[model samples]
Target: MFTEKGTLPDGIEYDGTLHSGYEIREQLVGDAISVFDDADVTARAVKNPQYLSVCVLANMLVSLGSIPKDKITGDLLMSMSQDNFNELRAAEERLDAKRKSFRAENKK
Candidate 1:
């Protein structure tokens, strides 16, 4: 189950079919690597939860082995409500704060 909001919901039927989170994640990883040409950039991008999220959803439609005749676009994500986007930004900020504090303490 997704711990965060704004992800495609699980446990509900889509076109009379459903997929497990494990399968979805596996596909997400595969699709992500294929989408990005540079492995290093893809690796770094995946580390950011927000960016990874975008990858997750972007892959969802095609993850189950369906080919996309049209290019998979991020227009849907870009149209997300401001509140949800803000929440994502806030979460990243919290993670950044924790990382900064941890670094400062370890440098002593």
Candidate 2:
């Protein structure tokens, strides 16, 4: 299931933290099953370059407060379908609202 669809650009390379894209996808599953930390969560996504889509991954992470828009790559994101992209965006918005409400209460 693990295959290299392309090569990393000469100037760009990723740290080897996962054995397979499946590993990265599986990590995303874990994120849903296990509660994420209150802090940023994007560094924890599945880093697959093929079957796994980064846009879907980044948005999911954003929903969890794992990554901000600045952390995601637009090139990779372009590969994701509109439906999945929308879901992630919706999740991000919902979570952002949740966070804001929590913060607002603390000031009261």
Candidate 3:
């Protein structure tokens, strides 16, 4: 299901399976400002705000269908800066554009 070409950062390991779309429907469909606002609050309330933020971002990324859940780990995620996440989102957008183009061409 994951056809992307990037690898996890070194020294990170994750053995989780890809999450189904159903698992993160709330994140996907919920209002972006609200979800993140909630995450921000939750992070501020917790002793480990940074860790919580990473989890929140990872879940959001998964919900967006940008990356498979299995491919993500806390360590791998921590290594990624916000710019890296943005890059990942951009890559997903490009892939989606290609898929749409291919589908439209073939449908005719």
Candidate 4:
């Protein structure tokens, strides 16, 4: 696991530790394919764009300040202020880019 820390605009600190790359890929693919029993619902959910980002962030976020990982959810994240949510998204993007760069360099 790789962990990165940052503070949200609301002064809440977050841990964005990610699971293994393989696990993330599998989970995302599985969620995309099976989020709903009905194909129509799944298709609609997937088409939202924010749906995937929310799912990914929910999985990657280990904690918010004193909050435990198990208590974090997409609904909780969605309920945050727009600035906080955007900050979280930015943090996730930064961590993801860093991870990708590290992997690319290591493959050389």
Candidate 5:
């Protein structure tokens, strides 16, 4: 399972057990707004069949290609809460602020 806070670039390394040459992926990710928008447009086209008549299938940029009508159930994802993201950002800020000191100071 992935962590809610593991939404950083380079956060994922290789999954040693699963595959060979570094099976890395973004641990957690943001919503695909474009995908959502395309799905919506396709949904509308589907509802009003007359609309498709105008385009004559000229534009699939919205869908990026053919969309599987049956597979789309309109399920979307949750965005990170401002409070939680801010907290993580603050923690990162604090760590960065102390980075120079941490690196320069001699460990006794």
Candidate 6:
């Protein structure tokens, strides 16, 4: 995993890691979605698509200050300050873009 360090609004340093698109898909489908019933998941997806981003962030975030990776959950992310949450979302986007660029340059 490739990790980049960033600072939160509160100045807490964290590491965000890049994940492959297939790994993200597996996280969403094989873990996040599979944990819930299909109908329930579908309703939640329709009502709160933003949660999918939370899941992806939780999956990619490697560390936050002293916080353990396993302790980083969607609820924990949601509980963060809006500025912090937005920073994290932006970090995820940056990491995703980097991963895509790397894949594009490496493709045979």
For residues 1-108, what per-residue lDDT tens digits would candidate 6 score against the true structure? 445557777433335542221111112344465424456545655678686566556666666666666666565666666877777666656666777888999999
Off by over 4 Å in 5: 1-78, 106-108
Q: List the residue pairs that clash in candidate 5.
A: none
Comparing candidate 1 with candidate 2, which one achieves the higher lDDT? 1
Q: Worst 10-residue stretch by lDDT in candidate 4?
A: 18-27
* lDDT score of residue 59 within candidate 3: 54
Tens-place lDDT digits, model 3, residues 5-92: 3432222323433322212212333423333455554554376756654555455444322344555544456655565555555545
RMSD, one per candidate, in order: 10.1, 15.3, 8.5, 7.3, 16.4, 7.4
TM-score of 6: 0.59
lDDT of 2 by residue, 65-94 (tens): 232334444343554456545554454455
TM-score of each: 0.35, 0.35, 0.37, 0.60, 0.25, 0.59
- The regions of model 2 sitting more than 4 angstroms off are 1-72
Cα lDDT of all candidates, in order? 0.43, 0.37, 0.45, 0.57, 0.31, 0.57
Better by TM-score, candidate 6 or 1: 6
Whole-structure CA lDDT of model 2 = 0.37
Deviation of model 4 at 68, angstroms = 2.6
Task: Count clashing pairs, candidate 2.
Answer: 3
- Runs in model 3 deviating more than 4 A are 6-79
| Candidate 6 wrongly placed segments (more than 4 Å) | 11-47
Candidate 1 vs. true structure, TM-score? 0.35
Please identify which of the two predictions, 2 or 4, would achieve the higher lDDT against the true structure.
4
